[model samples]
Structures are given as structure tokens and as C-alpha cells.
Target: MGNNILITGAAGYIGGSVLANFISRTSGPIKAAQISAAVRSEEQAQKLSKLGVNVIQVDLVDETAVKEAVLRNEIDIVVHTASAIDGRIPSHLIKALGQRRKVSGEETYFIHSSITTLFSEEGGWPYGQVRDTDTVFEKEKEIGGPHPVRQTNILVTEQAKAHGVTSFNIVVPHVYGRGSGEWRKLSVSIPAYVRTSMAHKIVYKFDKDGHPPAAHISDLIELYALLVEKILQKERIPSGEEGYYFAMAHRTPWWAAMDRIAQSLHARGLVAESKPSIWPSDKMAADYLGFPVLYVRAMGTSSGDLVPVNAYRLGWKPKWDEEQFLASIDDEVQAVLELDTVKATIFDLLTSADK
Candidate 1:
């Protein structure tokens, strides 16, 4: 029998890319009919439906609704990518999975999405490259966050395991590149910088230099597919917090990234100067751009070197490095300039053509 797959947050950037990649490329025991998308919008639903996907409208907060949806669909593998801040969704889904396992005598799996920001400290900066083996935790309450995604991951993973649900947690770094989905196209940080620069007509610089880690959306999705394939084959996956995988491709210095974007905008006559101007203060930067931009600015203030040793050991390779990522900036910026939509990216168009 084919494995039935259900992805929550089907309308989101990562989720959408995962859905498209999985449905378009998956083979050997996973069929397109076995794939279902739990989306929140009709527009997303219609678009996914056109792609021959099974779309189901889901309310992440509604425990009963989520449970009913899982059992009703007989989801063998549940990938949770939406709202990591909410702790109930994983528990509810695990409960439903337990019930299904009892009736059908089959095992279930849950892939929970997490962010690398959990590794950030208020003033801590690592001078050397850091790997997944370097990570250690104290307590969830001691951890600060814009959102407590890491803490929630720990809680949910524990609950899922306690309920006999095979859980895998994936921690992704600042994701770049275009995503092929119905709703959004461009990933965070870079596009935010581009849009902010377009709005202000110039690109600003930072005082210090820092290179944080990054991952291409396609590479991240590929890792997800590999892990899912292993799970379906009844292969052993590194479980628990220590065994969790960090999804990252390479590291790019903030100033270098700024230069690439500024060059693209300046060459296109979109910005006044390619040379960046130093921001006076965080508050002023936030005022000029937006709160989200501050997070990008923070990249320059600290070192976020995340090395994925586990990915290599598992034989998962990333196709795009910093150079390739930088080389594609012009295309991404040009897509936004020509299309007049933040969702438009050359990568998305290219990937969609492959389908």
C-alpha cells in the first residue's frame, strides 16, 4: 500500500514548497493520490487542486477539527510546518495517530518544523564554525524568543514519542531562494532587504560584519524528502533533541549579501547607491524599514555558524552554495521588479516548468 502523506501549513512558504516538491517528484510507494494538503484559504485550495493535490481546509487551533481531519484522512505521515508556537497541534495529532495505530496496527510518523534562531543568544557570537553536535540546551524557560519555537519543539517531540508517534524535528536556518507554491514565492531576509531598499531607494550597511548560515529552499525540501523516504522504508532516524537535524547549506556574510543586493538594484537603476550607509541605531533601522528588518540587521551583530554534520553523515547533499546563491540574486530581484509581486522569483518559474 502507498503511504498517505498530510502536510499542515500547506499554504505557507516552506510547506508549499514541500508539497509541490513531494507531489511532483516522489516515487516508489508514495503516490500523488496519497498526498493531501491541509490549507487555510480557498485561494490556496483552488490553486493546489489545479495541481491535482488533495486539499483539505484545516484550523490549527481547533483540536477536535485537527484530530478529526487526521483520523478522517487516515494520514500515515503528518508533516507539521505551521505555527510552531502553538503546542496543541502536535499533541492533538499524536492522539489521533495513536488511535489509528491501535485500530490498524501500523506505525505513524510526525515531522515537526523548527528554526535555528533558538541557538541565538543576546550577546553571544561564535568565532568559529559551529555544527549540530555543538548544540546543548539548559531549559526552555531560560531560552528567549520572538516565539518559543524551540521550547515547543522539545515539548511536542516528547509528547509524540510518549504516545508512540515516531517524531523527527528539523531545524532550518535563514532560508533563501524562490519557493514554488500557490501563495508566496520569495523567502524571508533577502526579499525583505530588497523590498525595504526599493521602498527607501537605497541600501543601508551595518557597522560590524557577520556571516550567518543559510539554506536554499530546494535543498531543504530535498532533505525533507530524503528523511521521509527513510522513515517509510522503516530505516532508523536519529531521534530526540540530540539527534535532530539542522538544515543549512552555507554561510554568507551580511555585508556581502548587502553588496549583492545593492549591486543588483544599482545596476538596474533602482537604488541611488550600491555603497551601503551605516544605520545609526536599531530603533532608527526599525523605524525606517520594519520590525522584521531588525532581525536581518541582527545578522550583522552576531555569528550564526550552523554546520549540518548529520546531513552529511546521512548522505544528504545541498546543491547550492554561497556563490550560486549570490549569482541568482539578480534574477530574483529582477523578477520582483518586472512582475510587481513579492511572490515572483525566477527559481519558482524554472521549477514550475519542470513540472
Candidate 2:
């Protein structure tokens, strides 16, 4: 099989950053391999094309188009970062990879990005303090709920196994720091909080405090690059049922972070007070933050007791700690002020279904 790789959602936050990481490598298997970026818009295609990678503008929901892109590009691996909830898109991509494997007579791989909140009590995970080495797939299937993330996770594992494609799920935590992508430089949770605070001229915090797992954007990208490097070198690592890699660097103290944000905004004359006010209700917070009401509480307050053993086993070292993340609140605010140009469409399906 050819060493060509395809990255879906190439214009999205995580996907675009992964693309940037792959291309910036000076000497590695990734540098020698052909890279293809699958974007959804002509504008995104044009902008990403300037980086000199093959940018394919194709709707991921279209199965035929997805298969064509994979086969034509001779893509051996697919880094799918499009949607954690939409199983259809990954289904198409995985099936396409299966077809490619048959044609090329070689193995194929799929790396799926998922949410860590699903493992918390608030997110319906009955078992507490789960490790990445645990049987995450079985437990998730046993607790089966209406959560789209969990459902999609099950879909990815099952479908990939059926297609004889090796799969790994990167259980993503609350990611922060400025991204190096061409589009959507800022992450979701913190930037939304900053925007909502500036809009109301006051910072709001949940009545209940949370300490969610988080990682710096750079560290998260490094984890991706490391996994890709391992795959390209044909190094045997965890895959299939035991491939849950938690991308967590530190724990984000929500109340404390909000307090710092309030103080920072107040010092800058952006807010009326230096102390954050308790959110009146989850509904108000959801409406203001533009997050799905059903998952907003979990997003803001659930801290999954996750023990990441897989990524670290692959020699993943994260430089950021809780202290560093707390100290960087000001930088997070500045990133929102400058690079919040791309409107997030990740929650579009959830919001529309709610309506």
C-alpha cells in the first residue's frame, strides 16, 4: 500500500491542527508520505492548499465521494476528526478505507476523536475512575444511552472491526490554548465562556464547581503526531478494543478559572466586577453559551476520573500543568478576542434536533 494518508474535517479545529502538525515535520515518515486534506468548503480548500498539501473539497456524508477520495488518493490511514456524534460520516470513511485495503492488499487504520465527558457520572457513565487500559468499549455499550458520542464510539469500534480495519479512539478532554489550524484557532468551551462573559459584561460560573481534564493545544497535537509516527514506522501499539487514548495534560479548575477570567476582564474594563456571579440556571447558561442544553451541565461541571495510560505508554509527554493552564487564562481571552472568526458547527446537528 502507498504511504498516502487522508485527514477528514481538514478545516476543523482538531483536524486542521493535525494537518499542520503533519506538514511541519522536517524529517520523519510523515514528511515522506503523501498527505491529503478533506475539507467541506471551496474557501477552506483554497486556504489550506496554500500550505502545499492535497486539499480535497468533498462532503463526508456522501459515501461515493468519500470512497472516491480515499481510493484516488491511495490513502492508507484516515484521521477522522469531523464529528464525535455523527456516526454516518465515520461510517462512510471507514467503509472507504476497507475498500482501499482490499484493493491495495494491505492493512488500514482509523483514528477517531471522542469526548472524555462521556466517562463522567453526569454524562451517564455509571462506572467511576476508569482507565484507558480498561474495557471502555464494553462498558460504554453496556451503559448504552441516547448520548450521540457514546453511540458513535460504539459505531466506530464495531464498524472498523467488521471491515478488518484497525482503530484507535482518542478520548479528548477539554482542549485549550490557541490552535495552529488555518481555521477556528480557538477551542470550544473556554472561548464560548469568554464570549458569553463579554456579551453580558460579566463572568458567570456554575453553582457547582468542576475540575475537568484538559490539555494544551500543542501537547494534544504532539500526541497525534506521535501516534501517526508510530503507525508509519510499523511499530506495534495498542489498537481495536484496547485503543482508547485519553489526551489529558491537566485538570482545569472551573470556578477558579472563571474567577481569574472575571478578574482579568474587570482589570481590562471588559466586565463590571472582578468576581464571577453564579449562573442563574443551566438554561440561561446554555442559551448564552450556545451549547446544547442537555450536555451543557456535563460540559461545564463533569470531571471524568480518567487515568490515561495508553498515550503515556507511547512516550507522550505533556508540558502543561494545572498551574500553567490557570496562568494562561489571559492568553485564552486574547485568543478569543483575535481569532474567533470561524463559527463552530460541531453542535449544529444537536441544536437543530432539539428544535
Candidate 3:
């Protein structure tokens, strides 16, 4: 039998899409592998069970529940897309993987999904213009602050190494495109902007223009599949501190995107104007968009100068580029109008703690 792989946050956009991508494979190392999904609720579990994978509903914050889910499933590999800010969840899973290795006498792997925004100046990255192949771990350590994502990244790397489990961090940028997942098909940033514009009857933009890295959901999923395929084939690409893979397919021009979004919404009769106005205050944007006030500015502006070399080196070829993304603004608006069903809980923890 192939390895047993478990994916956390199976009801989320990225996790659900990753699960869909894996199961849709007809023939590959992935097809031979048994798949399991770790979700938060019975509703989510039932929804994912239809995909023909083992679905476990467990509280990720509870270490016992997380460890039990890991060990009971014999999960040799974990694709954690649940929480980038919470370090404890990954810590528990990595510790369980260490125990699983001792019992099964086989290798285990942890693939952590992290925020690429952490590399941006607003996100507290001190180093200018970094590549995925650079010493990101050390730099993050050197410039450590109250940034939860950075802390989580450091914890995942160090904890996985200490437990003797192979770990890879996928530095995820602003992900666009509708997801193939069963639930929460809409991504966070664009959908929120579209929804906020519809509610307020106007489009808004940040005062400062920024070009953050971005990827279409399809291209990002392809990168994940490539990494998993390489790992299942026993190809030692990179792991632990050296395993940072920046999944940046293109750069998102924030002002241009908002302008296009404004035009799209105006055409749809959802907004009052075809031009985006500068946000009067970050506080208003945060309040209306339901984003945490602390990170709202970073979310709206702050483009990291990140160059990705790792994923491409591992044979990842993303089909989407800047032109394609810019051309798809209408599609992004349409997706929010149609598929914005699930309330995004990814920021629930962050926002609650902020209060």
C-alpha cells in the first residue's frame, strides 16, 4: 500500500481544492496513496466524505484530538492548510508524525501552507527582495516580531526538524480563481472586496499602490500536486529550513486590480461608479470588509518583493500570468456574486484574538 496522507482544513478553499486535485488523478503516485481529510465539523466531514476519502472531524486546537486523528489514520503525510497563524496546530501534528515514524518505522512529511504576505514590508519582513532559495528561515528569525504567521513558520520548521519529520512550507501569495473544492469555493481577498463594494455601492482602493505576488487557484494547486508527487516518488528536493517554496505565478497590481474590479462591478450594476476611490481610512475598510483592523492596511497595500526559484526548480510550471489575471477581474466578480456561500472562518481566530 502507498502512504496514508491526511489533509487538514478539508472544508477550506485551499485544502478542499487540494483534496479534489489529489482524488481526480487517474494514475500517479497520488492515486496509489490513501487519502484522508481532517475537518472541523460534522457538516464539513459529510460534505467531504462524498469525495470518497476518509473524513475525520476533529478540533485542531486540541492537541489530543489532533494527535489521535493523525495516529489513528496512520497519516504518513500531512497537508496542513488550516491555520497559518496558529503554531500549536502544526506543532501537535508534527509531534504525532514523529510518533508515527517510530511505530511504523517509515518516513513522514508535513506540508505547511503559509502566507506570502509575511514577506512584505507591512508584514514585517526586513530583507528586501528575497528568493525562495534564500535563507528565509534565518531572516524570519532575525526579524521576528508579533507577526503570528512568521512565528508559525518558524515553529513549523524547527518543530518538524526536532521531530525528525520532513517538512515543506509553501509560501502562498494572493490566491485568485474559483476553487475546485466542495465548499468555500471563493478565495478571501478578491471576494471580500467584491462583496464590500456591492454592499457599499462603491469601490475603494488603498492610497499607496503596490504589486504583490499572486497565483490563480489552479496554478497553486498544480504546485502542491507537483510537490506531493515528488515526495511520494522519494525524490529529495528540499525539506525543513531549506524547503520554502514560493508559489508566486504573477504580481498583482493592487490599483489596477481595483480599477478593473470597479469597472466590472459598475457594469454589473453592483456599484455606483466605474472608478475606485481611495479609502478614506483603513479603519472603515476593515469594518466594512470584516478584516482584522491590524492587518487591513497590509491586506490592502504592501507588496513583497519576492522571487520564486524553488517551485520552478522542482518542475512546477504555472500557466497563469499577470495579463491573464488582470483579464479575469470580471470572472472574480462573477464568482463572488454566485458562489459566495460559506462564511470565511480563516480569519476568525485572528480577529477574535485581536479583540
Q: Please give the CA lDDT of all the candidate structures.
A: 0.71, 0.91, 0.91
lDDT of 2 at 287: 86
Candidate scoring better on TM-score of 1 and 2: 2
Estimate, for each residue in 1-355, the C-alpha lDDT of model 2 and write its tens digit. 5678888888988888999999998998989989999999989999999999999999998999998999988889999888898889989999999999999999899999999999899999899999999999999989988899999999999999999898999999999988888986888999999999999999999999999889998899899888988898899999988899999888999999999899888888999999999999998998899999899999999988999999999999999999999999999898888898899888988977766
- Residue range 73-137, candidate 1, lDDT tens digits: 88888888775656777778777777777766788888888766655542233334456665433
What TM-score against the true fold does each predicted structure earn? 0.85, 0.98, 0.98
TM-score of model 2 (CA atoms): 0.98
Off by over 4 Å in 2: none
lDDT value for candidate 3?
A: 0.91
The segments of candidate 3 whose C-alpha lies over 4 angstroms from its true place after superposition are none
- For model 2 the local lDDT of residue 128 reads 90
Better of 1 and 3 by lDDT: 3
Q: Per TM-score, what order, best first?
A: 2, 3, 1
For candidate 2, the 10 contiguous residues with the lowest summed lDDT are: 1-10
Question: Could you report the Cα RMSD, in angstroms, for every candidate shown?
Answer: 6.3, 0.9, 1.0
Clashes (backbone N, CA, C under 3 Å), per candidate, total: 0, 0, 0
